[model samples]
Target: MECVGVRFAHSPKIYDYRFGSQAPPVGSWVVVKTPRGLELAKVRTEPRLGQAVGEIVRVATPADLDQHSKLKNRAEEVYWWLKARLRREGVRAKLLGCEFTLDGNHISVQYSAEQRIDLRRWVSELNRLAGARVEFVALGPRDQTAYLGTLGACGMESCCSNWLQDFTQVSIKMARDQQLPLSPEKISGPCGRLLCCLQYEHQQYQELLAELPRKNSKACSLQGVCGKVAKLNPLAGTVDLVTEEGSTVTVHKSELRWE
Candidate 1:
């Protein structure tokens, strides 16, 4: 049950593989047999006790690395060629990237389109031209954005393209619980989805909110003054109370008791 996590090129997701006879170090490259074909992947985590989906073929040799580099260049060429061909044929698709298996027996072409495209003819032509199997992969908005990386609203690289290995469920409720503005422009990432970071500190925010008085609830301050809870500052651990004297005052949560 010993397994290690491996990541493929141009993707952040990691796959667990069992190293049958090889002990590939972290950050090293290894050849693994995927469902599609034999692929070169980087070791992202050290070997640990876990379930593995696939088995590593072997540690990648220097020749394997060289071959991978050449295939990468060739994939770039094929991608451009396919892009131009698609444009000329008026095909409504955006080519994201192209990759070849380490053994050069298969080619994976990533693309995004509004609808399914019947590219049987193109696939055949590419197969004959490259002398390898060609397959098109349809990508969703999030995967498309991950393939073609861009800066995020935080002026840094998007998390999906950076170090995030898997996409998690992110909801507007997380933003609301964190007291963030509900504006889509402010909360959505380049993928036109809720920002992934919104879920990072959500649990902590929820815990803090549980200890604070709900808005519009009756509460008494430490000085024996009573007021209605107006607003909450979860981060600051303070609440804005509108006093019965018609004044808004900020008081720490510890200084207030809910009625």
Candidate 2:
């Protein structure tokens, strides 16, 4: 026999099902048994590398699909109710989204807030109406992108939703690398997290930096001795040269007309 579990994305939940002889193929949606009830979820990855401890079970039924769809809609409705209720309560926060397990056993609400919130009472009330085990998870900006994502400045789907598995910390130094302006509003996303793409190319820029001379190296030019590489201003393509003789001059990196 084999034991398999349905992996739920965007939430830390899983539905373990018994597979007697065979296992559901990867990425396939299956109905699994849980403490609360049966639920539907896609198999993200194949169950461990080996065969089952028991026999494989049957795939999901048509009725299971129908119930899954209904549960999803109901979860969305519950999310809206929470959103409206929170707004009425004067809590200004973002409702990232909600996820309902296929078994109808569990639901998770993802939210982004400025600070801590006491949603215990509200969550209990929701469970009474939802008639299921409810889990409220507080999501940060990066987690928000993982749950409820949108397009980025590059006009494509968010990296967090599509490819980024882990969220790496982002800082202002990254903005300075590609010559981006130091404006936080321009560099940050709606989630207020650093752009995911920053981590992608930082190494390339760092590698390219090795070939370039330091900004403080003195330049011995025919016109005079310059104190340091004042700037590699791309727009000007010039390094502002400060002279040992108390003079400042600009020289192009390509055209060292200084000679």
Candidate 3:
């Protein structure tokens, strides 16, 4: 079946929809019947490879865009309304935002919390105010950051919010392999997990590290000075060696020997 990539907002997620008859051009707005409801989404790409469980209703027109904008604005209002209501009810949760269906028939709210929140009343109140079905989507701290978005420690946009479609497991081993500061504050990102960028050059680091001796292992320089492998700089292709007298010297890995 022919597939298309449709996305409702600036979110990184794109949904695949089967459009057997309505193959619209990329960047065109189209109404799609998602499991949530009728969603007004933009055609990001054609021939998208995925399970197309949903079907395209029709190509959205100017009036549809106007209506979508108005409903989106109302959805934003509902987000704040829910926030205030939660605060008044003393519910512990952080509201990320709301995604409203194209026809304003349903709304899915993304939020984060430490524990389960009784949002049945909140959902009812929102449905009453919105005149639409309201859903609360529970998210992890990382997924919350991905949806709400924030600048990363690298002075750039968060990867997950921008281009990272899926998250990979990150661990302290990646940090140690990269020889970065082991401090949580230094290694952790806004998601309170290891920075996603740590995995960027990790494979290269692993390959380079394999070619060099491990730290604290026995190694000697070309000058016959041998002690322990103090530090390894893969980028510079040099290894810092500590002599028997506790003196240290930096030498290229090619000139070092473990024998």
Which candidate number maximizes lDDT? 1
Give candidate 2 misplaced runs (Cα > 4 Å).
1-27, 32-39, 43-58, 220-227, 233-259
lDDT tens digits, residue span 142-247, model 3: 8878877789998899998887878898889989988888999999989898898999999999998888899989888788888888888877787888888989
**Global lDDT of each candidate:** 0.89, 0.68, 0.84
Q: What is candidate 2's lDDT per residue for 1-259, written digit by digit as tens?
A: 2456565555333444566466788778766554435555566555564343232235777887788789889988898998899889998778877767776668878777889877777867888878778888888777777676577888887877765656787877877766676777778876776786877888776665443445667664545445676655544455677776767777765544332
- Model 1, span 1-259: residue lDDT tens: 8999999877787888999765789999899998888899999998888879899999999999999999999888898989999999999998898899988989989999989887677887798766689988899999888888889998999999878978899998898888788999999999898998998899999999999999889888889878898888999998888987899989898898995
Ranking by TM-score: 3, 1, 2
Ranking by lDDT: 1, 3, 2
Candidate 3 ranges with C-alpha deviation above 4 Å: 48-50
Lowest summed lDDT across 10 adjacent residues in model 3 is found at 118-127
Best by TM-score: 3
Cα lDDT, model 1, residue 225: 78
Q: How do the predictions measure up, each by TM-score? A: 0.89, 0.72, 0.92
Alpha-carbon shift of residue 228 in model 1 (angstroms) = 4.0
